[model samples]
Target chain A: MRPTPDPFTEALLARADDALVLGHRLSEWCGHAPTPEEDLALANLALDQIGLARALYAEVGAGSGRTEDELAYFRTDRDFRNCLLVEQPNGDFAHTIVRQFLYTAYADPFWRAAVGSADPALAAIAAKAELESAYHLRHASEWLIRLGDGTAESHARAQAALDALWPCTAELFEPEPKARLPDPVPLRAAWSATVDRVLARATLARPADGWAQTGGRRGRHTEAFGKMLAEMQSLARAHPGAVW
Target chain B: MSDDRRARAWAAAAAVVDPELPALTIADLGMLRDVTLAGDTIEVTITPSYTACPAMVVIGWEIEAALARAGLGPVRISTVLAPPWTSAWLSPEGRAKLAAAGIAPPPTAPADPGLFAVAAPACPRCASLATERISAFGATACKSLHRCLACREPFEAFKAHGDGSISNTASRDVLS
Candidate 1:
């Protein structure tokens, strides 16, 4: 019989899933970004996220002697614990930027706070990831300002994407039951302040909060998440135990 | 004989330069974390600067080759991710080497994305504070591109990591 995960392990698993899912999503744009430089930048971001996920998974599985691949590839969608925000469909360039901006806003402060985690491993990961995520936030913020204040069409699209994504932002602040993870309430305030400051500079309106979507923490993902996972895990599953 | 072999192995491994920087050796960069010897077998531990640094593969191979040249029977190069690497590890000589090669060393402070302006890196060429960041990323993963207004020359700055404070070398060099 399988043992129930303790609070720490569960929180770590959630962190890993969030990173792996979003990393895969970002990588889908590798050769497809509007500019060549952007392509490299997005890929770099994806690689950082994937690397973070690998480390988290390794730590989570160490006790069970399970490898990162086994946790990443063999797991079913039902087992994923990432928030719904990361798994939402990447709509357009504007949508992607908005999604990235909102997520990074949360991640930057979340990682900074995590640097003080009681768990040394988590603290170490946070120390490294905090730097990388800070860059991601800046990258996305610059794009937010550019798109929102650029052409009329760009401005309209940026606003539209913001409205579409605002609801998902709520999930980032929600915590798992009995989880020992750092409290995200302060993170939410920091994220909102950062987001508001950027939006003001970009001449964009802050969308009003609507009903916040939930359940991803409980592993209930959107329909798009399943397809994304299928593509991501296909190669690893096909070549079971393959090593370079 | 074993002591001779171990010393030779250390010398060889220390000589391998970082592939991306080329100007600095692994030892100079503080990347050669540790080397262990047990009879004829040796194990070397390396920590990569960035999570996605592609240079690690070449570095591992280079380490193997270096040890092999010393007539070491077999060697294992292990990459450790925890306790992650930091710019604070850059040696004083490594910092000089980077400056000489036209790459500004990271400031002692661990750079925060929110705090880029707090401790902007000086231009390695003219030692001018009048430098502006062109790109947060450069030709390599560990560097960011900056242009010096005084010299009208563009250069790369090694990113600062760990704690966001200037190291032994202060921003005073540029301000002066």
Candidate 2:
């Protein structure tokens, strides 16, 4: 029988999956971004996210003797624990930016509080992630404001993106029972403040909160996630232990 | 004999230059955190400047190779992330080397410019304060792209991370 993961491991895996999936999504835009500068920016964001994921996975694997690659490539979608928000496809530039803004808004505060975690290894990862997440938040927020406040078409797109992505965000704050790290529910206030301020500046209306999508934390994911995972894991699975 | 071995190991590791920023050694960039001799193994600890720095893998291999060439075998390299690396850790010599290489080194102690404040890094080419950031990110995760109004030249600036300071000014032109 598979042993049930402790709260800390569960929480850590959820965080890692969130970063890895999001990072992969961002990487899909590597050559496709509208501008050369933006291409570099998105790629850099992807790199940071992937890097954070790697570190978190390494931390989880430390005790289990599972390598980060094994943890990442070997896991099925049902075994993954990322929230629903990150698994959504990159709809458009606006959609991507809005999704990133929503996640980074929560992540920056989450990492900051996590810096004080009693677990030293987790704390170290948090410290590094906190710095990177701050930049990620800034980049996403800036693009979001520009898109939301720009010409009529851009503004409409931004608003649409916000409306679509907003519901998925509720899942990010669901309480992790017996979690040793800082509870994400408390971070919602700060995330809301950031979202509200940026939305106001961007002249976008806050989408009213309604029915929220859930279940990613328990290994349930959206339809798009399986396809993304299949692509990500294909190479690793095909070339098992293959090294250049 | 062990003391001599440890010193040799430290020297070898210290001499290794950052593969990305060739102007700076890992020592200069403060990437090398600690080196200790534990039994027959020499354990070296280092920190990454950014979580996703591509140079890290190369740096590890370089350190191992450097020690091996110095006759120090059984070396283990480990990375730490706590007390996260900041641009503030760049050594004075490293800063000079970076400046000499036409890249603006990060502000040693950045004044907490409130969020939305623009970064004004002096142009590495002309020492112009009249510089504006063009992009928040540059060739690497650790840099931002900037153009100097005085020299009309574009250059990369090492981003000042972890200081609660916003360095990217892509939305508004701060130069007026």
Candidate 3:
């Protein structure tokens, strides 16, 4: 049986998993994005997310005799703690933009607060991540606005994407009972304000918060997560000790 | 003796040029944080310009190689993230080198603008302030693509990487 992780480890893992999963999803658009500029932008964003995940995983792996690779590659779907929003597939450009915008809105403020964390290592990581998160938020917000206020077709697609992805965002603010880190609950107000301002400009309506999806924090994930994990872990599993 | 060794190690590490931006040394970019001789081991600390800067691995290896060549072995390289890196940390020399290499340097003034705030980067080719951003991202994470209206030349700008304040006291302390 696997040893139960402490609250700090669990919380840290959740953050890492969210970054890795979303990074991978963004990477899927590397060559497929609508424009050359967008292709490069998506890839750059993916790199930033993956970098954040690596740092967080390194922190989690400290003293555990497990490297970041071991932790990321060896973990199964049920053991992953990312929110449902990240593991969702890249349906279209509209879907990808909407997903990123929602996540970044939460992440920017979250990192800003985390910069003051009592944990020095975490604070350090948060300091670096905060700048990157700000860039991601700005990039996504612009795209969202353009899509929302563009032609009728683009507006419809952007709205549809936002509606589809809205439910998963609630899980991002769920309180971590055992964690001593910054509470995400308090960040919701700022997130809402940012979202509201962006949506107002985008001409997009905020979906009513109804049935919220949970369980990612508890290691339960959606179906798409399994397939994503399989692909992500395949190379490491294939070559147990491969080095570049 | 240890202080002398530490100085040598610091110089060796600082002299290492960034593989991506060869025109500037790591010191000019404000990436070399600290160097100390802990007993026989030399410890070096650095901060990446961006979280996922691809140049970091190369830079680390280059530091090791440079120190090794200088007989400053047993080096331990550590990365720090606090106070995060900003383009404001780029030395005046580094900015000049970047402009010479046909890339626009980031503005030195600290102005926190909104997401869609228009950045009017002066063109490196003709020194024209009438440049338009082609894209928010460029070939690397630390740059943005821009085109000059006067020169009709495309250039990359080392993006301003900060919240709203360009004057990073931590970086100033290090750079000074």
Candidate 4:
């Protein structure tokens, strides 16, 4: 029988879910991005996130007598623990950029802190992931600035995306109470600082902290998440135990 | 197996070229991690520079065949990700080879994360610092695309590996 995952394992699974879901969303833009360079950039970002996710999932399944594929594809929606911010729809290019920027801005420092995690394996993974997050943050930040300061249309779209996504931001800062890890509260300050810096440079204003939605960390996700899972898991579900 | 036989087997394994960059051998690329020989069993460990590097399979096949050709059979290839591979592992000789082949090596990890610190590598062709990054990612996961402003020549750079510049073999050796 598969052993029940501990809290730390759950935390890893949550982190992995965040990366995997967002990676899938970002990869959908491949061959469909605004430019060939942007296509590569987005795909590169997706690869980094997916790589991180794969590592984390591998760790999670190591002693559980389970495979990473089983966890990623066989699990139901209720078992997922990604933040709602990531699972949000990639509405438009502006929307995708905004979503990516917000997540990377939070993730960069979070991974940096995780490098010191008491769990050495997690620490090693974070050490590798943090650099990728840094690059992702930079790419997203550059696009935010260009779009926000470009034209009236671009500016409006950037702001609109920001407003739409802001409600999901607070959930990222919420602490995982049961996880044996550093307090996330301190990381919140750094996240805001980075976000403000990018927004200021982009000439965009921070959306007023309003009714902050939550629940992705505990498995409750938005409606769009189900469709995403259906599509992402379809092939794996169709071919059980099949090797690529 | 004798110690001399094991040493020869390792040397033969190291001679395998990276499938992506033909100029540099696996040892020069720092992909060859460890080789253990017990009797006729040879266990070889490698670390991939990129998580999804397609060249890993090809490199594995090459290593196995090379070891076999060296009269070292029953070879096994495994990968380790804990101490992830980094581009800084590219030996000084490897860097020169890359430059001679018109591929730029990535800059060191920047101290501060304020700006995109992928400073333009001096163009291998014209030896110019005046270069622009045409794309943040290149054909492979471990490279980025750059174009030399001076020579109007485009090239790929072996990107710095892992987070914050930690590599499998780079922490110990400094490339001049």
Error of 3 at B3 (Å): 3.0
The true-versus-predicted C-alpha distance at residue A11 of model 1, in Å, is: 1.2
Per-model TM against the reference:
0.84, 0.94, 0.94, 0.90
Q: What is the TM-score of candidate 3?
A: 0.94
lDDT of 2 by residue, A26-85 (tens): 999999999999999999999999999999898778756678898899899998999889
Error of 3 at A205 (Å): 1.5
Q: Pull out the clashing pairs in model 2.
A: none
Please identify model 1 stretches exceeding 4 Å from their true place.
A1-4, A177-180, B1-9, B36-43, B72-78, B81-83, B96-104, B107-134, B146-157, B164-176
Task: Please state the interface RMSD for every predicted structure, separated by commas.
Answer: 6.1, 5.9, 6.0, 5.5
Q: Considering lDDT, which of the candidate structures 1 and 2 is the better prediction for this target?
A: 2
Per-candidate Cα lDDT values, in order, are 0.81, 0.86, 0.86, 0.82
Between prediction 1 and prediction 2, which has the larger TM-score? 2
Give one digit per residue, the lDDT tens place, for model 1 in B1-176.
76777777788888899998899999888888877787668888888787767788899999999877777758988887656677888889999999999999988766354422444688898899998877776677788777898999988899776553213311111101
Q: Write the per-residue lDDT of candidate 1 for residues A1-244, one digit (tens) a residue.
A: 4567776887889989999988999999988988866877788888888988987998889755678998899988889999898998878999999999999888877777777677878877887787677778878888898999899999999999999888888888876543435677777888888888899878999988879888888889889999999999999999999988
* Least well predicted 10-residue stretch by lDDT in candidate 2 chain B: B167-176
Q: Model 3, B128-163: lDDT tens per residue? A: 999998888888888889999998999999887774
Worst-scoring 10-residue span by lDDT in model 1 chain B:
B167-176
lDDT order of candidates, top first: 3, 2, 4, 1
Error of 1 at B15 (Å): 2.3
In the range A102-216, model 4's lDDT, one tens digit per residue, is 9988888787777777888888787677666767788888889889988999999999999999999999888675345657887788788888888998899899998999999
